[model samples]
Target chain A: MTLTTQQSKEAEIGKKANHLVLVVTNDTIDKVYPPMILATTGAASGMDVDIYFTFWGLKLLDKKGQTQTKIASVGNPALPMPNIMGMLPGMTAMATKMMKGKIKKYWPTIPEMMQQAKDMGVRFHACSPTMGLMGMTDKDLIPLTDSICGASTFLDWATDPNSVTIFT
Target chain B: MLGTSLATTDAKPAMVLDTKGLLCPAPVVKTSQAVKQIQVGDVLQVLATDPGSKPDLTSWSRMTGNELLSVTEDGGSPKVYTFLIRRMK
Candidate 1:
């Protein structure tokens, strides 16, 4: 295709700035919230938001995992606890479960959140290397994933001046 | 002995940011957007309920170089936090 001078100029202006996000997580239930929250807000703020799901983060792309994501609470550092009680074991899992319940009670399920992200035109990218390591195929991921790419590709997308590279 | 009390008042333009019923990132996100619309030296009042706002707003103020005048509880709701922010150019 050939581009006219005006068209090329407009394209350059449009490409001058954007926001990019890298969401890396493997923490089961609570893992999906950070990326989804940040990406959705970024889009709302008139920025281009790209989410790269890799390694354990890839679990968020799994249709099955989306239905069962939960928040950890038992031993979560973020949770307020007495100094002596904070040292208990298995607290994280309990906290995760508690958090999961709280979230489910208030917001939509992870699957619904994924669908909302898709509806909002957020770009979801699955990590090709992670897929290979985990023995997952493209078909195993949610339909929202636009492509499977590498770190270099993500870095390139984040090169613009207005781009805010966030690791959620 | 008798004592008398005196009352004093000060005038300043106040801005309101209603972030109630919203969650993390939303409150901060909305607050950031609202702050952009005000002039330097203007004061903004933000109402929110997200437990994360304390740190979020604090950090946002520090990073953006704005002034956080105060953060107080609203109507006794542990989650209902109000912030007085002074816009800094």
Candidate 2:
């Protein structure tokens, strides 16, 4: 069957543009959100998306991480409670529950978003060097992770025309 | 200009997706999925309530190479935004 003109144009455009890459460097609830949001958005935009989790970022991929949402508030400027109060026991969980309540109506939860991102073809990469430092294995992370890779390897893949690479 | 205008003014939509009460990526993501269900060159009309969905869907369509035929805003208070997009791939 002959391809329609619109379909041909789409194929041509897809051929011209490469994927978007995001480097996640932190695990704190607030910090982890940026990369997740971008990866999810990139997938929805019909762009291939890769998120490389390194250092503390890898913690987010841990099965324990996404199971419970906790926002680090000790130094967070956005935290409504006092810094001293943030250090109090159970405050982090309280803050996390509050945040979850606020966002439940308007957005998908972090774990739900992660599943959706995966369904939309977003790739998650774990940093090998960081895993070695943290004494972790593939068993520690969620099943969505695609690879345990080095920085240079990902950098090599990221270098291209019209590719969006972000570090956060 | 002629082609764009023709597309914007009179391209009849093949499907309508109602995304009211859905927010941010939901509306945009739903539009993305809805576009895939139609044939190439067929228009998909999306009704979204999220204020952020317009720019998000606009940029998404740009990145995906889909044709954004028109965006019409309805009502004044708590406006309803309508997007008409044609499937390309």
Clashes of each: 12, 0
lDDT of each: 0.69, 0.80
Task: Give Cα distance to truth, residue A92, candidate 2, Å.
Answer: 1.1
Instruction: Write model 2 residue lDDT over A66-153, tens digit each, in one string.
Output: 5665688577768887788988888888888888788787777778888889999999999999999988888988898898899797
Q: State the displacement of the C-alpha of residue A151, model 1, in Å, after optimal TM-score superposition.
A: 2.2
Q: After superposition, how far is residue A32 of candidate 1 from its true place, in Å?
A: 2.8
C-alpha positional error of residue A147 in candidate 2 after TM-score superposition, expressed in Å: 0.6
Give model 2 RMSD, 1 decimal.
4.4
Error of 1 at B57 (Å): 12
lDDT of 1 at A79: 71
Model 2 chain A scores worst on lDDT over the 10 consecutive residues at A1-10
What TM-score goes with each of the models?
0.57, 0.86
Q: Would candidate 1 be rated incorrect, acceptable, medium or high by CAPRI criteria?
A: incorrect
Misplaced by over 4 Å in model 1 are A1-17, A70-94, B1-20, B25-89
Please give me the DockQ of candidate 1 compared with the native complex: 0.07
Each prediction's DockQ against the real complex: 0.07, 0.41
Residue clash pairs of candidate 2: none
- Model 2 alpha-carbon drift over 4 Å, by segment: A1-17, B1-8
Candidate 1 per-residue lDDT over residues A1-168, each given as its tens digit:
113533454455465445757676564665677777776655544567788888878878876665655454444556776545545777655666767677865555667767766665688889998889988898898888899999799878777676777775
